[model samples]
Target chain A: MRLKATNIEHFYGHEKILHGIDLEIEPSKITAIIGESGSGKTTLLAILSSLLKPTNGDVYYDDISENSIKDINAFRRKNIGFVFQFHYLIEYLTLKENIALGAFDEHNINTLMENLGIGHLANRYSNEVSGGERQRAAIARALVNKPSFVFADEPTGNLDTKNAVGVFELFKSFNDTTFVVATHDKKIIDYADVIIEMEDGVVKCISKKRV
Target chain B: MITPLKALRKNWFKTLLIFISMTVSISAIFLISAISSGVVGMYSTMLKTDGDIIVTQKGIADTFFSDINRSLEPKIINLAGVKELNSMIFGASPVDNLPIVAIYGVSANRLDNYKLISGIYPKNDEVLVGEKIYKMLNSPKKIKISKQEFKVSGVFKSKIGFEDGGVVMGLNDASKIFHKNASMMLISLEDIEAKDMVEKINNLSDDIEAKTTDNFIDNYNQFKIIKTSSDIISALAFLMGILGIISMMSMVVNDRKVEFGVMRSVGLSSTAIISRLIAEAIIISLFAYIAAIALSYIVLEVIQNIQKFQGYINGEITPQLAILVFVISIIMAIFGSLLPAIWASRIDPMSLILGGSK
Candidate 1:
């Protein structure tokens, strides 16, 4: 599925967040939005995923604008999955049930966990797992529904270098799902198929991987 | 959801506190109701006179201070609704300085208030004694009160509580000994409209208050004070429960704001989140209900077993009253938690993300 944002402008009480940003998310490819803290990468990612509405302009999923859809929540649930930087898991639920919250079908939780390499930690609560394991669990949740677009904001912000690399490699394996990640991590930026660099709410550069 | 259940389990102490409080409140209500019923039963038996109206000194509020002029007897007997009237000259006297002994003065041949078991009704110098008091007087045929020698005319037995502990004598003789005129008037009405008759009697004289026996407890100053004060205590207990629940739920919602945000981000709508919180509140209330019912039952059993008060009073909860208590408990649970639950639901899903509400 194609996610396109054209001239997306967002403001928080007159404080500009994203300024007239235009971007096309390639189908089934890993797209990374990289910027420093407060540079609007998370804001841009949120706009593309329909989690937040833009103050001006629009976002389209395969050519259907966000405002044009009658049921915005249904659209998001059916096609988009979100992963926050902090893992944001239900603390009382086992990692398995947390992943099942976004499962496309009932039987996909185990497969999703195994695909993310957190199968052994399935029965453990979110509080009982390590930071890296929690991120893997979050990744499993985002893809468990087989959503066309998975929006991840700073997915490895809480993980060590080793765990961060492991999470990216796991994202790389799901080649059929489009991943849109916002991060300031250079190691994560190096592995993306397309990179969007932003500074102070404006797009600084858009680079395509040569390989 | 299991998340809310786990949260309830985690705060078991709160649930127990509420349960104990509810149990105490409900048990008190049950106890008060039982005692009140028992007291009414006793009054019904003692006041079983054919008289429908009791006339007392204005604002005396107690029979001890009731004093009416003996001269009014002829006038009162002529009033409308006056089927037949009897007057009592009653006071407490001590035998050789013993504990208080109750004494009532009655006219000749009016045996409606007593059943003679031994001797006949007393003349001016003799007295009729209750069965229990006769035993206390060592079953003697004679006793002396305030140095006056009186023969025990008969031993009468009545199940009425206070009457069973007292003595009776001739009206003029009692008046002479007690140095009082008439104590009060007991008038039997020919009609059932007791209120209207009482009003007529009260209007005829300004020194007396006339009322039907049905309004006895309501007009009695001590009883009215007790009822009003008990009602206040009960109200306070319920208010404490409501406030306790509101504060506890508010804390819970405030602590879990971020968790609710995460739920919204995943797939839960605002309505779903509100439903979850309501479910949690209900679970807590269910635990409290079971605990309170058990505790209240135990309290009632303890009260009913007191050897002295046994068979005289019973403590229990009727089905309708029990239902009312349960309904109030559930409403307390729901009303206390609703505002907090709504607040939790209105939380912005974005604010629940990383660095949100920081």
Candidate 2:
């Protein structure tokens, strides 16, 4: 599915965070949104993923605008998944249970955990596992539902360079699903098919890499 | 997929606080209900007589204070369906150091209701002491009432609550001591249907009123007051319990806001989250109710064993009371969780995740 945002604008009280942003996320590709602090990377990622309703303009999945959908939650539940900077796994639940939160078929959870290379840690709590392993579990949870689009906001922000590269490799391996990662890490440019760089609250440049 | 048990287990301290609050509140309700029921039960047993109808002073609030002229007994006995009439005087007097001791003065025929435990029936200056009173008085051979000394002829026990903690003597002696003619008269009927006889007896004298045993018990004002007061107190305690649950659930929801946001971000609907919270509240209430029942039962047993309450208070946790507690618990769960559930359903996931990010 194609995700498109048209002239998106956002405000936090009196201050404008995003200004007239236009972008199209191609299907089955990794689109990296890179910017410095206070550049509205997280806000734009939130707006594009339907997590936040834009102050002005709209986001569309294929030909259907977000405004046209009667139940935005139902829409998100059926098609969207999110991975935050902090893994955001429930402290009481095990990794497998956390992953199962997004799973339509619980039976597929074990195989997905195994594919994420954290199957052995499936029964470990989020606090019990290492940071890299926890982030892997978060990724597994996001993809467990087989959503068409996975929006990750600085998913590797807390990980070391080796673990961050490993996370990008995991996104690369999942070729059938589209991933939109908003981050400060320049390392993601190596793995992304499309890189959209931002300055202040506006897009500075867009670069496409040859496969 | 959202099970409440995991959250409860993880937050055991909060769960324990809520559990203790609910248990204490529910136990208060159950204990008050049991004691009230016991009071009514004791009165019912004491009021039981072999006669079909009872005659007492008209418009009296308590039968203990009823004063009917002894001359009316002849008229009551002559009424149709009247096979026998027994006059009795009831009063309360301090004996020795005891604060209040129930005194029943009846004719020898009324002695049939008591089972002799260690002594014969009393006459004139002699009195039969109740088993409990005898023990409380240290099995004394004599007890003084109203500046008059009487020999303790024997000890007796009875199913009637008043008879087990009271003194029984001849009606003439009681009249002399209490300075009253007679408190009430019990009339036995040849036929069980005594409704007409009651009316006839009532019309015979202006000071006396007649009532079937069932009618007399149903209209007893003391029992009604006791029951109403108990119910009001129990309701207040139950309300406190509900408030405790609401406060606890609201705190839990506030503490888990970020968790709820994560859940929403992962595709769980707001309704699903609220349902999970309600389920948790209900589960906590159920456990607390069970604990309260056990606690109330223990407290009741301790009370029943106390010397002052022995034979007079037989507190039991009836099935109806248990079921009532269960129903109240469910109500507490639902009402308690309503506001918190609404608050939980309205949580915006985007802001929480973004807030955590920045």
Candidate 3:
């Protein structure tokens, strides 16, 4: 799905977080928003995924206005998926149940866990696993529905280099879905198809990878 | 389903306390109402003889304290709707070291077969001794009442505790021994209602009047206050159950806010998540209700089997009332968790996911 944003502006209370931001995302491509802490990368990703509404601009899905959709929750469940930075796996649920939350299909769970190399931790609760394992489980959850667009806010920020690379390689195998990642990690940015650098709530530069 | 259960397991002790309090509140209401109902029923039956209307002195509160003489009795028998009248003279005589022996002296008509539990009714200076009083005697066959020797012709039982330990004999023997007259008269009516006859009897004289079961109960001021107080206690016990369960569930919901937020992020709809929490609540309520029933039954049986309390009252909750009380408990849990569950569903994944608020 192609997403085009025109003049997106956001404010948290009286403080502006995103100022007149504009961007375009192509279908079936990995777009990375790179910035340091307090740089509005996560805020932009949240707005684009329809998890948050910007204060002053509109987001369109394939040029169809998002505001016209009656049930935004249904829309997100059907199209967009999210992976948070903290590996916020529900402490009460095992890795498997967390991933398959109303995904409408369970046949792919075993294969999906095996693909993420978290098959051993499928039945283990979040507390029983290491930090890297929890991060991988969060990614598995974002992809369980095979969503057309997957948004991640520092998906591998909590992982070591080897585990971070492993998580990045897992994203490379998704041929049908687009990956929109917000992170400051150099290793994750190396695999980006397009990198939008942000500084002080504004886009600073746009860099594309050479194939 | 398993998600909520696992979360609840983390706070099992608190949850168990909620269940315990729920059971306690329900059982308390049941026990209190049962005992009050039983006591009211016992007194009501003992005071309510086989008559549509009872005639007594106007100021008397209890039927046992009424002492309208035979002068008022003939006037009552000649009333328009009067079919038959039975006069009962009752007194408490301290006999055989038992300070309170309720004695009933019946007029010629002792035809109320329900009062006789075993053998023939008293005849020829004989008496029917109460089952409890007979048990207290060395020889159950005979007993001395009013300083006169009388054979214990039969044993009788009355659900009322006072009458269950009393004696019954002829009216002539009572007046001859105690030199006192009738205390109350049990009057039966034909076509007119007892209250109508009561109105006529009151118009006839100021010394005595007639009262149906309802009028007597209205004037039974002591028990009226007790009934009112017991009803409020019963209602408060029910309220305690509702509030306790709701608060417990609400607190549980508060503690699991982040977990619910995480679940919402995983694509579970608000309805799905709320239903899961409600399902967990129903399971808890069901277990607690079952435990309440079983424990109440055992405790009630134990109370009833005790020697002094054997015939008092059983605290068995009616199936309908039990189901209703348990349903209210579940509804309390539902209301308790509902708002919090909805709040959890609406939790911004931004705050919880990014640790932004922290």
Best by TM-score: 2
DockQ of each: 0.37, 0.64, 0.50
Instruction: Give the residue spans of candidate 3 off by over 4 A.
Output: B1-4, B44-228, B302-314, B356-358
lDDT of each: 0.76, 0.86, 0.76
Candidate 2 lDDT by residue in tens digits, B146-204: 99999999999866556788899999999998888899888888965788888788788
- Model 1, residue B189: distance off in Å is 11
Best by lDDT: 2
lDDT of 2 by residue, A1-211 (tens): 8899999999999999998999899889999999998999888998888888899998999979999998877788778889989888889999998898757789988898889899999889999999999999999988988889999999999999999999999999998899999988887778999999988889999999986
Candidate 2 regions exceeding 4 Å error are B49-52, B83-86, B159-162, B186-198, B308-313, B355-358
Report clash pairs, candidate 3: none
Q: What is the iRMSD in Å for candidate 2? A: 1.4
**Fnat for each predicted structure, in order:** 0.31, 0.61, 0.51
lDDT of 1 by residue, A1-211 (tens): 8888899999988899888998899988889999898899887887888777899998988898889998766677678888888888877779998887645586978877887778999899988989999988888777777888888988998899999999889878888889999998998887899999999999999999998
Q: In candidate 2, how many Å is residue B291 off?
A: 2.0
Worst 10 residues of 1 chain B by lDDT: B306-315
TM-score of each: 0.69, 0.91, 0.79
List candidate 1 stretches off by more than 4 Å.
A1-7, A11-14, A50-76, A101-107, A144-146, A172-176, A209-211, B11-231, B294-316
